[model samples]
Target: MEEKYFEISTENLKKFIDGIITDNYEVIAPTDKDGDTFYGKINKFEETNLDILLPKMSYKEYLLPKTETLFEYSISGVDTEVKDGLQNIAGANEKRVIFGGRPCDAGAGPIMEKVFNWDYKDEFFNERFKNLTIISIACEKPDNYCFCTEMQLSPESSYGSDILLKKSGDKYFAIVTGEKGLNLVKAYSNLFTETAKDKVPADKDWKKIFEVEKTKSFLDKNFEHNYFQERFLSCIGCGVCTYTCPTCHCFDIQDEGNLKEGRRIRNWDSCQFGIFTLHTSGHNPRVTQGDRYRQRLMHKFKIYSEKFDKYLCVGCGRCSRNCPEDIDIKEVAKNLAEMA
Candidate 1:
């Protein structure tokens, strides 16, 4: 709290995490079980993993939640009735500390805040965000399609992160961005020292490998372009990219089970699928795979920028990582720019 930046020894990083866990803080980080990424309350700091390279999915799964029950309903006779059962987040009373979130993953939180709170104030999202404190880990290298710079976002982006952490040498350099971040550091002041000059990322420009401007230009010029027959021709229409994208915030609301007893639930959805924009009247808005594919790029570059004045794509390249169809976003962006 003395200065904005503080340093803790690499040796103490795990210990500090353990201490947070001891304080009843739900410490969530990347963990592997059968080579699958799972985030849960870590019982020990040793459970914190930063060596997974790139997680196929973003950390938004924890904050936004994959499924949420709006309420429960039951019918008596002719009148259908519903009762509120869920949608409660004990923010003030609950505390969360999320660690090892990449800049792209962490930055999506603030961007999502606008839409979730725009038309109607979503108390559920706001509560989760308020109670949650993020500690973003700076990325060391750029993935194939990642152009964080295109959106003026970087591996060092401090958007939703309460505490920013950079791995420098054997130590981790940290900075507190909000009151919660400060309190967190203060809670474990003994484990940390005053801001150390030696704890800065040696190669701060490590992300220069990805061409941000080139990617943006490609996206801008390809507004009227359809990537379907070209780059996405081999795409199996799998919604893997949407699931991997940090900024892809689409969900489906469904009422399942019998009409007498039902519940409204929200589940993660993808624009890549034909059913995404399907209307109840049976007229599918985005019927073609090409249209769905183009929507993905358009939403990231134009629509999101128009709405939030910020590009939605974080350039994490998770889409490339998870694409079973071998769709490469970097090549697609570059090809768009080159062809134009």
Candidate 2:
């Protein structure tokens, strides 16, 4: 909100997006790879995976990263191993933008900013977030397992995007939502044209977009759907769902190698696993898969909603799409709503 903003047609939207990426910094976006779609760096507009509904993993990798060297310490002749990690953070360039991201994924950015920048400031994480911009695109179609409608996020929700690109008939209608978004528009004046006809997207009503919101209002009523346990009874305790969910933000930090020369690494973790909160004192908090499954549903719907006033899910359907047990979130929400 600290900068000027504008709206443009989706046709010229990609031109503006590609134009920004064409400048300094390497651009990355989601792309379909064989049967599995992944997010990676790209050079051209044709390679973007705009049609793929969900990515293989969340965009957490861009912020926290899988493996990182916190700081390396060495000894010359014993009693010398401390060094400043911030010695050269400024000299290196950390400029880049992600194009064609989804509203759900981009929305997680600000939500993530809260906890990451809280307690004690993580300069490493904050530094990375400051230099990057996220351009989220609107979802055109809902997947079978998608429950975003139940969670109050429509296809065009723009909670945490620098720029939001809405798809029209053949063109895209782009809207700048942040100062960074405004900077992108102002920086590339040639890529955009001032439209006088109020360039806001026309067909973005929630009642029109959501087919199940009116009929399947069970999602609002089913806070205590007991059958989900029976439905998920076939689950083999795979963490794939939690891993692929865009809003699931639990992780574990680990140290590998010998004690004297081990590197501290943080890896993606899931609550579906029994050991997620295992105490070092040998008392298991969540003893069974049922407890873990119940925790996941309640946390997403009941807990997160109470805390953040927003459902932790974006309804991208990556969990059900990649789930080996085919546990559909839509079916669960519908049944719960119906039972209620």
Candidate 3:
């Protein structure tokens, strides 16, 4: 497909965003909340905050909520009935824009879509994904833990982004990638002007080198390797990495309420906990922190990729940033690659 480029100054960008608000579409962007940045709902032009680094959490929560009700059931004596639990959001059917998303955050949605659509389709997730438009802001100042380049993705990667915006002087160089993006551009054509693509300097420093293939190969042959036991000695099993990850999608189904009335809920779960794999017989296969940690790495680099032709991780670095023990994934991958 031919790439289309447009230029929009700061003023025009604000106008375009305001137009979205006027049209009754929700705009979610990075915002400062309690001195930390997070993807939040924006009502005005001034609400969007892009000066900070990446948000603490990825935008996954917007699509697959942290907690969702699957269905509701009620019973009185001998009568029992089940009912749908989905409640429509206000203007949910309208297009929602994820403005100013980073490349890694924007790219993770499509990677996760694979599993949700596999075997059985998750209707709840699909509905939100179908109605959403992703607008990515290319990274200019990646931090120390960022290793997207090592995972074969760059700041400019546009795998799941409908539109990509790169800052060029006082204006932005924008590229519309899909039908939704094209429609948005055409609707706001007056705000955009044709321009050349911005030139990225070669001296821009990113993170460490990685051998993704080597890491996968090592895991394939060393399924019983001692490094899994030795490397996770300091792990506290807090599950912070999995919770903050852009790609981890494990969940637990729970029934809430009394015996007379109840709602089945799907809440996010993590493999880091022993109860995550505990059976009714009280036998837990992944009993140790090392075993759980190994499963995390295996699913991310080896198993998921082998099944879906894509790595489960997007190299966003959120896991390393939020890990209490400072266990960096890039460091683990580098050590595995160099191992005998």
Candidate 4:
């Protein structure tokens, strides 16, 4: 693919982000809040905290919100008026720049796009994506939890990112791609300096890349296997895994208000919940916690891949890291790989 590379000093990185904010663009970056880093809207460049690891939440919320109004209705006398609840958070009206995002988080955008655009196209997600520019920072020091390599992804993978930045010495090498990325480079031309053609920084911390193909092969034959129950017995049926995941996009729609008027709202939902697949007759297809957990694994590793030709997981390892039961996805994948 055609790409343009430019180098910018570490000191000038703040100025580059500040310039985007000054131009009336919403700058969303990793911001420190209560000792935890989260992707939040930043008014100034100083508000961003890039030193932390991956944020507790993914950038999916920016694209598909946790809670959004679908439409609003009002009634006066015998007349009723219905209005569309349009979303303005990072849409055509206000442009967005996601800076200092991890590559795995950046990669989630494309995977989620496939699901959103499947049979029924979602206009809200489509419009906001067009107006957003992703500026992802390559991980310099990945911990044991990082397993992007297993998913055929890495700190350097620029799958869904517009611009990928990697730290090299005292400067950051920016690899520009897509129309929005090139436009940013042209606008802030002074901040970037032309670098050597062959200069590319290496991610030293990422050493072990798991055998994903082997794991997929095992999962292909183990759908009805009894191992799933034992594997997920310790799971507490919490929705933390789906909530922190970047590609989990299940949602529930509910209408709120009295008989006079009401508003339909869409909120994030998870497959781990017992009521997620419950029918109106009080019959739940996934009855036990193990059943829910098995569905989660199958959806991520088998079902989604069979339908979309891509795995639902990006291997960011947040699920494994935050799991109270210490159910490491990487270990599970490795066990499956050994079975094959």
Candidate 5:
């Protein structure tokens, strides 16, 4: 379908969201939690906190949960019985709408989707993704940590978003970019208008801080460079970077139960962990923090790009913002570009 545009007043936008909630759609939005803003389920539009450019964490958990059960099994004498966990998962068949996410967060969806469907189709990830609708708000005031423009994406890119919204005075210029967005507008036709308002133009002043292609070239040949060892000396192997990253998809699966019964579960894992690559024979591939950090960079810039023809990062800067060592990925990429 061709793209369609419309304008909606702020009042009607609130009503639209409240109506979605009233209709029993699982609404996920940036809401105030503890003292900071995070993506979480909201009961109404009033609970959303859209004052910030990006939330503390992306809405990835709604699609790929932090911990999920693959299946449950029970042992009876010599026979084993299994049960599909998807049948028991809550909200498995409900539609989910993610509103007020930034473009960087929205873009992570397609990047992750590629990985889930590469070698084998991940039904667990696909089911949630298929039911999700992204309504991202364009960035009006990006902070210093933002580098979406450098990653070949803009604040208003609308790459993975169903509907991209840009606030203009008392209304929003909404661009319906996909089938889901068109269906949403058709379902709520009264909330949107065919006003002749001009769509918000992309920011011309948003500069690209580094050339990603050049950085990739440098990483392609300099896998064992001394820069990795010296630059990552401060890394403490905390795995915080991978946990907060929008595009990191590494996970670990475990079976927990006694001889009677048990369930196979998948949990989020990180390459930064010291034992991530440890072998039962007491051998470790990535022994130092530098080696693990280098793996992280290589996976994001070179490995994934070589396979998917796209970078595995959306440049959301959550790692740098939440890192205890204050490591900045943008600076690292710029330094690699300089080296190239």
Candidate 6:
């Protein structure tokens, strides 16, 4: 279907969201919590905090949970029985609407989706991704940490969003980019005006800080470069960077329970951890923090791109903004570009 444009007043937009909630769709939006903004479930439109550029964490958790059960097994004497864990997930089939995320946050869904569907289909992630609708608002005032433009994504880009909303005075110029968005507009026809808003408001002037191609080239040639070792000296290997990153998808599987019964679960894991590559024989491949950090950069800039043809990063700046050591990824990329 061809893309369509419509203008919706702020009043009507609120009503539309409220209508979605009334229709039994779970609405997730940025909400204030302890003076920090985080994505959480909202019952009404009034709970959404759209003023923030981005949330502390992306809405990825809603799709790929921090910890998910994969399967369950029980042992009876010498016989064993296994059961699928999909039925154990609460709200696995619920329809969800992710509203007011930034373009970077929305762009991360597709990037992660590629990995989930790479070799083996991840039914756990696919179930949530299929039921979710992303409605991202374009950024008008980005701060120093934002670098979405460097990753080939602009504030107004609708790459992963079903609907992209740009603020224009008291109304929003909405661009429906896919079938989901078209169906949404059709359902809420009373809220959206027929009068088309042809022109979307201009995006903020977010300058490209570094050339990603040059950074990729640098990584491709210099895997053993001392830059990675010397630069991340302050990195305490706390795994906070991976936790806050929108595109980090590494995980570890563990079995829990006694001999009678147990469940296999997938838990979020980080390469930044020291024990991540620790073998059972006690010889770890990535011995130092620098080695672990280099793996992270290589995976994001070089390895994943070579396989998927898309960088495993959206330049949301959450990893840098939330870093206790204040180590910035944008700066690292810029430095690599200059070296190249």
The residue-by-residue lDDT of candidate 1 on 1-340, one tens digit each, is 2337788888888888888888788888887766777556678877767886556678777656789887888898898877763336554426788888777877888888887888898776777877888888887776556766555777777767888888878887887778888888888899887665445555365444444445556667665565554556676778999887877889888888696788888899988887778899999867677778878877876667777777777777888878988787766655655554
Measured by lDDT, the strongest candidate is 5
Candidate 1, poorest ten consecutive residues by summed lDDT: 84-93
Residues 131-249 of candidate 4: C-alpha lDDT, one tens digit per residue: 77999999877777788877868878888999999887888899887888988888989999876658866555545545877777887887777778888888888999899999899
Model 6, span 114-219: residue lDDT tens: 9999999988898889888889898887778888899889878888999999888999988888899888989999888654544665566767978999999999
Candidate 6 local accuracy as lDDT?
Answer: 0.89
Candidate 3, residues 1-340, lDDT tens digits: the string is 5667788898899999999889987899998899898999999879989886688998899888899888888998999998775555434746799998898988789888999999999888888888899999888888878878777677777778988988878888787788889889999999988765554323255555877888998998998898999999889999999989989999999989998999989999999987999999999998789999999999998999999988888898999999999999989987888883
Clashing pairs in 5: none
Question: In model 5, where do residues sit more than 4 Å from their true spots?
Answer: 76-79, 89-93, 195-205
Off by over 4 Å in 2: 2-18, 82-93, 118-120, 208-229
Taking the tens digit of each residue's C-alpha lDDT, what string does model 2 give over 1-340?
Answer: 6423355655566676577567766677888778777878777677787777767876767766665656655555565464444443533436578777787777777666765765878776677778778888888886666555555666787767787777667665566767787777778776665443355656455552343333234435553455655676787788988877766767777755543454555577889987887999988877766667767877766666666665666666778888898887656655554454
Indicate the worst ten consecutive residues by lDDT in candidate 2: 208-217
lDDT of 4 at 171: 86
TM-score comparison, 1 vs 5, better candidate: 5
The candidate that wins on TM-score is: 5
Error of 3 at 85 (Å): 2.8
lDDT of each: 0.75, 0.67, 0.86, 0.85, 0.90, 0.89
TM-score of candidate 4 relative to the true fold: 0.95
CA RMSD per model (angstroms): 3.0, 4.0, 2.4, 1.8, 1.6, 1.8
Model 4 spans > 4 angstroms off:
87-93, 202-209
Off-target runs (Cα >4 Å) in candidate 6 are 75-81, 89-91, 195-197, 202-205
Pitting candidate 1 against candidate 3, the one with the higher TM-score is 3
TM-score of 3: 0.93
Question: Using Cα atoms with residue i matched to residue i, what is each candidate's TM-score against the true structure?
Answer: 0.88, 0.83, 0.93, 0.95, 0.96, 0.95
Q: Is candidate 2 or candidate 5 better by TM-score?
A: 5
